[model samples]
Structures are given as C-alpha cells and as structure tokens.
Target: MARVRVLMAKPGLDGHDRGVKVVARALRDAGMEVVYTGLHQTPEEIVEAAIQEDVDIVGLSILSGAHMTLIPRVNELLKENGASDIVVIGGGTIPEEDVLALKEGGWAKEIFTPGTPLENIVEWINSHVKSKDN
Candidate 1:
C-alpha cells in the first residue's frame, strides 16, 4: 500500500498540544508520514505547509472554539492555492452544527471529537485517501 502523507497543524492560540502530538504519533505508527506543525499556526501557514509538503490530508487540531473561523479560512486558502484536492479535516471541541457547516463549506471530511478512536481515523484515511489516489 502507498503511504499517505498528512500535515497535521495546530491553528490559533491554543497552546495545548498534547492531543495533536498524540494524534501525530498515532498517524505515523499507522504508516502514514505525518508532518506536525507545532502550536500557534495561522490558516495561511497551515495551508502553505500543506501545499509545500504535497500531503494527501491536512488535519487541523483546534481546541480554542474557533473552528468556525479557522476551518473555513484554511479551506478557502487551499482552494485559492489550487490545493483543493488536499483533504481538509479537523479534530477539536467544535459542536455538531459547526462540523456540518465546515463540511458544507468544503472541508472534505468531518472533524473528529473527543473519544473518537484513533483506529477510526486511521481507517478513514486509509479508505478515503487510497481511493483518491486511484
């Protein structure tokens, strides 16, 4: 199987990085090459890194209740840079309504919340990204 590339980022002022680090490690252990951009990233920086890394997925880790603003900004930046094929997903404290709004705003995938198994994320990427490659 081809290795999937994922750029995981922490956008905004959320300095709490334990979750993002854990997820990044899990993704790497699952055989995907993971590039983690440390805390305090802007939407522009995240999108730029995703494009430069040529990743298959751009996963944002936001816990500051700013998913509404950040997710859409990243999505727009990706579209502007012609990196719309890069799947944009997230994991944060966002509400269900916000998740639906993000999907509607072109996030390609839904945000994973607390208690969501790492296996589920791994499986989702395996299925979705692999299919995209074909």
Candidate 2:
C-alpha cells in the first residue's frame, strides 16, 4: 500500500499555525507524506499546490472565521482544475452551521472541531481513501 499524500494548508491571515504543525507531524508519523503550506495562503495557491503535488487529500486549517469564504473557494478551484478527486477536510473555529454549509457546497467531507483525536483523522483518511479505489 502506498503512503497517503496530504497537503495541509493555512489560508488567509490566521497566524495560528501550532495546531496545523501538530497535525502535519501526526500525519507524517502515521506514514503519510504531508506538504505543509505555511501561513497566509490564498485559495489559488493551495489548489495549485494540491494539484502539483498530486495529493490524495487537502487539509485546510482555518481559525480566522473565514471558513465560509475560503473553503468554498478552494473547493470551486479544485473542481474547476479537474482535481475534484482530492478530498478536502478542515478544522478550527467554525460554527456547526457553517460546517454544514461547507458539506452542502461539496467543499469538505468532514470538519473537525476542537478536541478531535488525531487517531480518528488518520483512520478517516485511510478508510475514505482506500474505499475510493473500490
């Protein structure tokens, strides 16, 4: 089995990166190759990196309350670029309604709120990505 390729990005002016770094390290430790795009990335940059890297998943860590704007934009860009196979998920200070909106917009498969276990994330990616081949 091949290692999962994950692109972890922090979009917009949200300067908090500690959580994203932790998740990246955890993903790496779980045998996934993680591409961490540091702070202040635009939706275009994130989508371009995801395509160029050929990542299996794109993880957006947003704490700036712009989830409504950024996540959908990224989703649209990915779809337009023919990279819709890449699964997008997010975590951070997002309201439940916005999370639902994201899902409805096909922007995210899941949104992890605070206190979600890292192991759960790894398991989710493994199951979801593996099942895609079937």
Candidate 3:
C-alpha cells in the first residue's frame, strides 16, 4: 500500500491554528504526507491546494463557527473540479448538534470535536483514505 497524502487547511478567518498543527504533526508522525495550508484560507484556496498537492484527503480546521459555510463550499468545489472522491474531514470547535448534519449533508465525511485523541484521527485516516495509486 502507498502512503496517504493529506491536505490539512484552516479556512475562513480563524487564526487559532494550534489544534490543526498538532493534528498535522500527528498525521505526519503516522507516516502520512501532510500539507498544512496556514491561516485564513478561503474555500477556493483550500480546494486549489488539495488539487495541487494531489491529496487523498482534505482536512479542514475551522473554529469560527463557519463549518457550515466553508465545508460545503470546499466539497462543492471538489465536486465541480472532479475531485469529489477525496475524503473531507474536519476538526475544531464544532457544536455537537451540527456534527450529524455536517456528515449527512456530504460536506464533511467526519467531524472531530475537542478532546478527540490524535490516535483516533490517525486511525480514521488510515482506515478511510485509499491511496491515489491504489
């Protein structure tokens, strides 16, 4: 099997990047190639990076309570660009109530809330992301 390539990005105006950075490190340590697009990335920017990097997954870290707006835009852009097969996962201060809708809406395949273990993130990616070469 090939190594999984993941693009981790922070969309919108959220400057809080500590959580995403930690997860980026964790994913890197787990043997995945991680490209972290730094603060204040728009949905289009994130999608472009995902395509440029040719990543298997696009992980968004949003804490500005704009996951609803940002995630779908990214997802829609991916579909529009014919990259919808790329898995989309997110982490940050998302509310419990919005988790189900986010997943069911096909925007975010998974949503990791605060206090979620890094190992869980690693495992989820390992289980879900099929390498592009496969």
Candidate 4:
C-alpha cells in the first residue's frame, strides 16, 4: 500500500509552530508522507493545497482561538472543491467543550489538545486515515 499522504497546516494568525513541527516530524517518522504548509496560512490556501496534494488527511494546527472559524471554513472549502473525501483533523489550544461540535459538525474527525501523547496521534492516524492511493 502507498504511504498515507497528509497535509499539515497552521491556519490563521497563530505564530507558534514548534508543536506542529514536532507533529509533522512524528508523522513523517511514522512512514507517512507529510507536507507542512508553514505558518499564517488561510483556510482557502490550506484546502487548495490538500486537494492538490491528493492528501488523505488535512491536519490543521490552530492556536489563535479561531478554531470555530478556521476548521469549518477549511472543511467547507474542501467540500466545495469536491475534495470532501479528504478528512480534516486539528490540534492546539482548542477547548474541550468545542471538540464535540467540531466532530459532530463533521468539520474535524479529531482534535488533539496540548499534552496529547505524540504516539497516540500517530496511532490514531495509522488506524483512522486511509491512504488515498488505496
């Protein structure tokens, strides 16, 4: 099977990237193809890149308290572009209460908060995300 292709993005005004860089490295180390879209990316840019990359998953890192806006917009843009098959997930300073809505709304399949084990994230992706080539 082809390796899972994942697009890792930092959306909105968040400037800190150390955590996302670590996650991207971990995902890559896990044998997945990881593409990181640097910092201050808009939702549209992220969606376009994910679709263009043919990624199985779009993993967004948000820390600007704008999860409500960023995640949904990305998901919506993906759908509008006929790439809704690409799963969207996120991580960062998002609050616990919002997790349910993000998942229920189908905007994000998962959301990892600060302190979540890196191994757990890797395991979750291995189990949940299917490679597009499959």
TM-score of each: 0.93, 0.94, 0.98, 0.98
> How well is each residue in 1-134 modelled by candidate 2, as lDDT tens digits?
67789999999997989889999999999988899999999999999999998898999999999989999999999999999999999999899999898988778999988888999988888888742323
Q: Is candidate 3 or candidate 4 better by lDDT?
A: 3
Better of 1 and 4 by lDDT: 4
Task: Report the lDDT tens digits of candidate 1 across residue range 61-133.
Answer: 9899988888889998999999888988899787888888887866648789888989988888887785244
Q: For residues 1-134, what per-residue lDDT tens digits would candidate 3 score against the true structure?
A: 78999999999996999999999999999999999999999999999999999999999999999989999999999999999999999889999878988998888999999999999999999888889987
Ten contiguous residues with the weakest lDDT in model 2: 125-134
* lDDT value for model 3: 0.93
Colliding pairs, model 3: none
Per-residue lDDT over 88-130 for candidate 4, one digit per residue giving the tens place of the 0 to 100 score? 8999998888988899888899999999999999999999988
Q: Which of the predicted structures, 1 or 4, would earn the higher TM-score when compared with the native?
A: 4
Q: Go through the candidates in order and give the clash count of each.
A: 0, 0, 0, 0
> Where in model 2 is the C-alpha error above 4 Å?
131-134
For all candidates in order, the CA lDDT equals 0.87, 0.90, 0.93, 0.93
Highest lDDT scorer:
3
Stronger candidate by TM-score (1 vs 3): 3
- Candidate order, lDDT descending: 3, 4, 2, 1
Candidate 2 accuracy as lDDT? 0.90
